[model samples]
Every structure is written in structure tokens, then in C-alpha cells.
Target: MSAHQTSSPAAEAGDPPPVPEATRPVRARRLPPLRRGLLVPAALPIAVGLWIASLPRVNVDAMGDLGLLQVLPVTYFAALGLLAVGFLAVLREPRVRQPWAAGYVLALITVIHATPSALYPALRYAWAWKHVAVVDAMLRHDGAVPHSGTLDIYNQWPGFFQLNAAVLRVTGLHSVLGFASWYPLLANLLLVGPLLLLYRSVTTDRRLVWGGVWLYFSVSWVGQDYFSPQAFAHLLYVTVLALVLRRLADRRRAAAAGTPSARRPGAFVLVVVLIAAIVCSHQLTPLMLITTLLLLAIPRRNRRVVLPVLGVAVGLTFLWDSTVARPYVSTHLSDLIGALATPDRNATSGLAGLGSAAPGQVFASWVDRSLTATVFLLALVAVVRHRWVRRTGLPLMLLAPLVMLPSNNYGGEMIFRVYLFALPAAAFLVATLLVPPWPHRRWRAYASGLVAAVLLGGLLFGYYAKENMNRFTAEEAAATRFVTSVAPPGSRIVSVTSSLPGGELGYDTHERLVLAQDPLDQRRLLLTDPLAVLQSTMDDPRITGPTYVILTRAQEAESRLTGVFPVGTVGSVRAALDTSTLFQRLYDGPDAAVYRYIGPGARPSPPGSVQP
Candidate 1:
């Protein structure tokens, strides 16, 4: 179409001859839509495979279904679609400003930060029920999974369980380990995306931004990195941070110009959604959100938006819990609150020595391998000196974590996920201090040392934390295997209360054995179901037949049982005991003993037979 003559720029005089038309201003060739879709499936397998491969395999069966092809396709496609949607949704915003070079570095830091718990199976016998019970309920078409009458609901955070079940429906993965581990990995990785966006919003220095990110995952003063629902809450907290900052900025600019700020409905909407997601994920998250929002409000002094935002947040939280969580919580409040207040049968005072002075214990623990304490101290110092404390609402943000210290000992406080809020704030405050227009050389060194200390502290703590749990893994594995081997196929074995001291903690794990149908036929494990046991006794007057009972010798419950023979003893399952070898598995630790039900004429008791 071009008989066009080119411009005669001083023609070929000052510059070389004009470049050929073919090479001039060439456009990138776009891939066809079909080609684009195909690339996702084709490229995905390789990436998913690589991601899966990178995961360390210790008792990988505990990881569940990584190799199971049945659900892999569903997970891959779902993750792909989600990522695509997120990308499209953010398209109108400015492109993410962080350098691509940091991807590997940030990922490495994430791995290091997550390293401690990363090695364990996603479905540990402890708390495994929280997830697997939901799976069981979905499979049963029961309204929800069934638990003893005394317990208000079958599990905690039933909503989160339902979400996990939805994944199972799409993927057709029934393995407790597979579903638990895989979703967490996916959720955790997705968590990084918002954090990156947050980093870009807060600062531009690549190193400082990443350091903040590093601290986000590294610091476990709160357990967000453990890949529980709290991890999801942490991401939401970041969004809240970004939103708060933007609102503050808008307010400040408006005030300076003597005009009203752009109080967009969209900003308010986003804050509402972020908060809903957090609450939907876990009940404890709202405390952090409310606290942070209040802190952020200090700078803006703008109630025009803040008031509405708070109202909306409160409304959504009420909606989430009221719909399902609150009803159950209300029903079970006495039980839960009671459990929290009373020291459990095997309970150690969670706060025994962890007073203000415990920082030394923390420091000593981290001296060899981790830098968490150093990182935190530096962040604390940086926060104070850099004026982040007084300048932004962050000073108040620090209080969220502080509030958790007292709660740890006040009954059920140690278990409350509310403690997680401190992690993001701590991390953010630290990064804010370190990255910057260093006012002085001494500040730079101090900031650098602070980061180093934190890094060192995290590494140390993570190492010991893992080591401390080594024997725990061995014992748990052995005990689980023994239970699986001895129990009859499809037999709903009621685990003695002693078998799971502090049932609240081990509930998740108990639920998983029921899911995996472990070799011992641990298809349905019942703990503290005295009514069920009493019913079984009534059904079989002969006290003869194939019925079996699992009991813990000399436990309070066993003593209460009046008359039940202890059939056999298996391995100890305590988390605190340390020594172990290949030949023998310890069945008891500093905590409790495990016993199997083996009396003759045993039968599962009918429901409603025994009263507490």
C-alpha cells in the first residue's frame, strides 16, 4: 500500500541511510486466542510439576496426593483461572512496579520463612479434623460433619472447611493430606501477590521492599507462616494496609489544598471485602483489622470515610459469623470458653515462663541459627527512630501484637489466631525503617544490622523449632500407623481422651485419620464420646464378640469408666518428648498415654445412652 516516499532528512548526510522499511516500527505479533488458551494448559503442567518437585518429601504420604493425577488437573486449572482473573482485575491499575529480578529472591525468602512447618504433612493428626471433617460432611451429604453432642459444632471455622470441600469437589481429591497441603501452598503463594503490590505502594527501594516482604513471612511472633487460615488473613491485612495508606494520602492532600478528599465508594467497598474475607477465613482476624484501621485513622482525621468503613466492616463481620459461625459459636461458647479457662488435662501453663524476660529465652533459642530477634529489635528501633512510630498510624499498629501477650495465658488465648496481626505490622514497620533516604550513615548501619539480626534470629528459631519436633514426628507416625493397623476396617474407633490430650489441639489430626482410612482402619476416630461407649456396652450384654475398645491406661477418663479392660498398648504420641530410635516408639511423653479398646463383647454405644 505504500508508494510513499521517505522524508529527505538532511537525507543521508548527518545520519546513516534510512533503515529498511521492514525493520522500522515493527509491531509485536499477537498470539491467537486459541493459542493463548492452549499455552496455559501446556505451560501449566511443567510449572506445576516444578513447583511440586521443589517441595521436600518427608513422609510424603503425609503430603497426601501430590502425585495423584485425579485432582492435579482441577487444582492447576483453578489456580490458572484465579491468577488470570486477578491479573485482568488489576489491569486498569498501574503495572506492578517491583523489578522482576526480585521474584527468585523473594521466593527464596518465602521458602526460608516457611521452612519450619513446610516439612510436615499438611494434615497433621493435630487439627486435621478441622479440614477433613468438612470433607466427610460434604461426602455424607450431612448438613455438616457430626461430632459428640457436647461439642456445639463438628469443627471450628466450618466455612473454611466448606471452601476446602469445594476444592475437593472440583479436584475429586479425597485424601486429607493432598487437599490440606496443596491448597495451603496455593493460598500461600497467592498471598505473595498482594504483598508485592503492597510493597510497591509503600516504597520503591528494591532491597527494602523485599526485606519487608522477607520479614512478613519470616516473623512467627505470630504463626501466619504456618499455612493456616491466618496466612490468608495476613494477605488481607496487607490490602487493608494499602487501602489505609491510600485513604490517608487522599485525606492529607485534600486537607492541604483546603478541599474535601475523594472519598470513593470503591475504597470503602474494598475495605469491606478485605475484612469479610478475613473473617470468613477466621474469626480472630477482625480484631487486627479494626485495630489497624483505627491506627491508620490517626493520620487522616477523616471520619467521612472512616466511619462508614467501620460500619461496613462491622456489618460484614456480623453477617459472616451470624450466618454459620456465630450460631455454632454461641451454642458451643460455654464449652469453648470453659476449655480455654481450665488448663487441659495435660496442659502446661502456656505462659509459664514467657514473660517480658522471655525475650532472652527467645534470643538464646535463635543465637545459633535464626535472626528473628535481631530483625525484630532492629525493626523496633528503626520504627522508633525513623519516625514511622509517630509519623504514621503504625505506632498504634504495634499494639495489636502486644494485646496478644496477655491473652496467651488468659484461658484459650494461646489458640486464638488474633495474635497473627502483629506479624505484618512488625514486618512492615521494620522494612519502612530500613529502606530509605538514610538520614545518616549510622542509621544505615543500624538498619542493616537490624535486618541481619532478624534474619539470623528467624533462621535460628526455625532450626530449633524443627529439631524440637523431630521426635514428635517419629512418635506421631508410629502411633498413627499402629492405630491404623489394629482397628477393624470401617470401624469407628473412639480414641481414648488420653490418646489425645487437649483434644482441641489434636482435633485436626484425628479428623484426617478418619479421612485417609489409615491402615489401622482409623476410618472414624471418636474421642471423648462417652455416650457412644456407653451405648455400645448396652447393645452387647454378653460383652463378647468382635467389638473393640481403645483406652488409655490409668487416665482420668479410664478411671471414670469404672470397668474396662486395657487390651493392648501402642506407641506414645506426645509432641514434647525428644529421644527416639528405630526399634521402639515411645507411647507416652511428658503429657499422656494412649490405649486401644480391646475388651470382648464390645460394641459402639448408641447415641443418647450416657449422660455426663
Candidate 2:
């Protein structure tokens, strides 16, 4: 042997020739299965235990403008920390463990999303209760809600309500309210599968895949996951995107192998079905889907597969808008066109001024803004640093929804919807910055865990900070029920805002008016002379039947937090009603009150007297 070829002890002993260090493959050190399995299992119970113990300590009634964050115990935050550390530790294992990572993600979802449902006695969001009312309308009218007034939009896009109506009938349940509070938890859980499919299709790195999933849930503080059509349609939208991307991946692999790509007729059919469902369920998601597909089709390699799906989506959306949704579309056509001309307004419409919001709410809003900016900043860094992200069209997907920002504000919620649709791609891109494809030092795990903690901290604030307004009390629900039951069809119901629970219970039969949503001049009049505004609304020629005004804690909270009315508007209005004989108190409670307006010429009644 040449002197340059140094012989090792193994070679001297007649063992196989020693492999050269430079040419040898390196294997990452993996955690033992026993250790990996025990970490998450132990952490899960501790986190869950901490959460359960903290629940009883929550004071829902005492929640201030900061919402759940103001009332949630320190133990709740401690639980989140433990879960974050456990997830990071398990994720850093050289060979990522699927079950452990998924378990931590699911546990986080439970602690964050399920806490509100558990703490609040009644359903949380007023919009969710309104959606339940839509389902009730469907059940009452035998699957058709005619003359739904402004709520006719729900009638036009009735797929979500129809599905719930069927579920209620099949299960023999009386109302969606039974399971509505849990919908956030359920909707988030349903997202896990498609998220996995999407991340895996784009990359083979397990760390990136699971990290993206964790980050998706951590920063998804947009409160759109309530029991609404948009939430359901969003699930369908993510599923369709996942399947299409998987197909793209398959075709890419087949081309590299120089093999004929097999046709996936079944998958194509499934994608079409999901797209149709999305088109029918919500008006906005379909447009989002089409924009995303058109962007995905920009690459020549992806065009063949993507253009067909895009065609179907566009056709279905056009057909739906031109037919069943025509009334709403035609009515709002000019406004939509006008919105397209003012992209700046469309983009900034959802960003209300913080000066009028409560101090705590202002802080919460800033936290949400910081969190969203951080996610996008990190994703943008990933795009600049990682070529594969752009190559895979992830950036395109992340930015495609921006196109809608210049089209229509979607009633001032277009910004949030854009964030919602863009989150999946943004999450994965951000994960690429934190979770390396190959094993590294222990400090990376700690650093990633620290980032996770900050993201979750922001998430808690963004999601629960408005619970003071979002949550409805049992008394509020009862008051709304009483008003709905006693008022005859064609009666008018007025409220400080639409935040009252069950406010839309009989929306089809009642003409509803929100003082906060009134014309600018009228809303200003409310701040000055609320009683006069109420009296005028009652005496309007259009309101031929009974007129009732509802004042509730949730409405007051919403008015204060959103600056829809001055700080003490609801209270001042209530006091005015109490002093005036023209208004008769029908139902009064600590959390809510209902008052009926007597005719202007009726004789004045004694104070504190209830009309028979």
C-alpha cells in the first residue's frame, strides 16, 4: 500500500477497507423512541391539567376591554409555555415524530380555541348566533327563506345553513346553538389534515412541514373561525388547494423520472366537487380560490393541470353570481366597481382608528398588527433567502389574495379575509426560517421555541382580547328571546349595535335597525339625543307594527371597544328611556333590557310602571 493511503486498525485486522471520511454519508443523531414518546405524553397532561385548573379562576363577567387576557389566569399562560417547549423539543428530534408533533399542535388548539367555549355559558360571537338564526329560518321555511330582508344574502348563499339544517334534522337537535360554541375548536381541528397535505406536497422536510402547521395555528388569530359560512368554505378551499398541489408534485416527479404521468380523473372530480361547494357556500372564498388558481397557473409547467381547475372555479362562481346571487350582485355592482377604483380605501378600510377604541382594545389591536407584520416579514425573508420557496410558487400563493384588496372591501373585512387566505403559505415560508431541513445545534430549538412563545402570546391577545364584546351572557340571550317571541311579524327591533345575542332570531319576520350602523348624521344624533333617534325610528311610516329597543352588555362593550358609539352612549340611552314615559319597559335584567315604544300621543305613564 502507498504511504499516502494510511491503513487503519480495521484494515490491519482484515476487516473491510475503511471508508474515507470525506466520501462517507453522515447520519443525524435521533432521539430514542422511548424518550421521544414520553416528552409529549407527559407535557400534554400537564398542559391540560393547568388549563383545567385555570378555567375556574376565569371571571367572565369581570372581563374588561382586553377580554380573556384580562381575566385568564397565569396558569393558562404557563400551560401554553409548556406546550410550546414540548413541541419544540419533540420537533428537534433528528427524525421528526409525526404523532408527537401533531399531538402538541392539537393540544395547543384546544387550549387556545376551546377556552372561550368552556368559559362562556352561551355562544361567544353574536355573528355565530346570527348564523344559527339563519339555520332556524331555513328549518322554519322548509329549506327556503323568502323575504329575508337584508339577510337575503344568506338565502342566496344558503349552503351553510342548509347543511346545518340537515345535521339538526338528522341528529334530532333543536338548534345549532347546542354545538355552536364548539365550532371554533372543530373548524381548527379540521384544518390539520389539509395543512399536512399542503406542506408535505411542497417539501419533504418533516421539520418544515410540522413547524408550518404549528405556526399556522399559532398566528391564526383572525376570529373568522366561528360558526359561519366563510369558515366552512375556507376549509373546503384549503382542501382543494392541497389536492391540486399534490397533483402538481406528482406530475413534477413523474416528469423527472421520464415516466408517463397517469391521469387522476377521480382527484379532478373531487376537486371540482369541492370547488362547487365553495362557490355555493360563500361569495368571497370562491373569488379567492379563482385568484389563487390563476396565479398557480402562471407557471408553464403548472398551467396544464391548473387552468382546468381555474376554468371550473371561474365558471361556477360566475354561474352562481349571475343566477341565485344575482339580486345582491346586481344591487351592489356599482359599489363593487367603485371599490375597484379606490384600491387605497379598499386596503385600509378594515384598519379602524385606534384613537376612539378603548385603551386595552388599542393595545390588543397593536399586538395583532405586530403579529401580522412579523409573520409577513419573516415570510418575506424566507422568500429572499430560500430559492425553493419561490420555485414552488409558494410566494405566489401567499400574495395572490392581495389582488382582492383592490377589488372590493367585502364590507370592510377584505383585509382579514386576505390574511386568512394568505396564512397557509406565509406560515410555511416563516417555518423555513426557523426549522432547518437538517439537524443543527440545541440552541436552534430553544430559539424556535422562544419565537413560538411570542407568536402564541400575540395570538392570545388577538383572539381573546375582544371577548368582552364577543361574549354574550345568558341574560342577554334570554332578553333577545323574549323580544323575538313577543313582537309580531313586521315589527321593528332597534339596538345600539348588532352585537346582541339572538338579535336576528326572527330576522325574516322583523325589520332590524342598528343605531351604530345608521347613517353618519343619525349616528351622531344618537350620541347627542338617542331617545329622539329611537322615537323617530319607531314613528317611521315603514314600521307599522310594534317597535322595541334592546340594550345589552355585549352591545355596550362592542360600542365602546369599536368606537361605534361614544363610551357611555348605551347607558345614556337606557337612562333616557327610563325617565321618559313614552317608552315602556317590557323586560329588564342586569345584562339586558327590552323597551317598547308607546305612540307619541299616548298618555304619559308613571315612572317604574310596566305596561300590561
In the range 1-612, model 2's lDDT, one tens digit per residue, is 311122444234222122221222447556554336677668878998999999999998888889988888899999998888788777756567788888889999999999999988899888998899999999999776876888998878988899999999999999999899899999999999999999888766677789999999999999899999999999999999999888887777666556888998999999999998888889899999999999999888888889999999999999999999999999999988888899988898888667798988888888988999899899999888864566676888898998888788888888888999999999998987887433455666668778878988999889999999999888888888888988898899999988988888888888889888789999998888888798778667876788999999988899899887888888999999988878888878889989888866776456355422
How much lDDT does candidate 1 score? Answer: 0.43
Q: Which predicted model would earn the best TM-score?
A: 2
- What clash count goes with each model? 39, 0
Q: Give the best candidate by lDDT.
A: 2
Candidate 2: give the clashing pairs.
none
* Tens digit per residue, CA lDDT, model 1, 304-353: 54566666667777776677677676875686556545544213343243
TM-score of 2: 0.93
Q: Give all candidates' CA lDDT scores.
A: 0.43, 0.84
Error of 1 at 478 (Å): 10
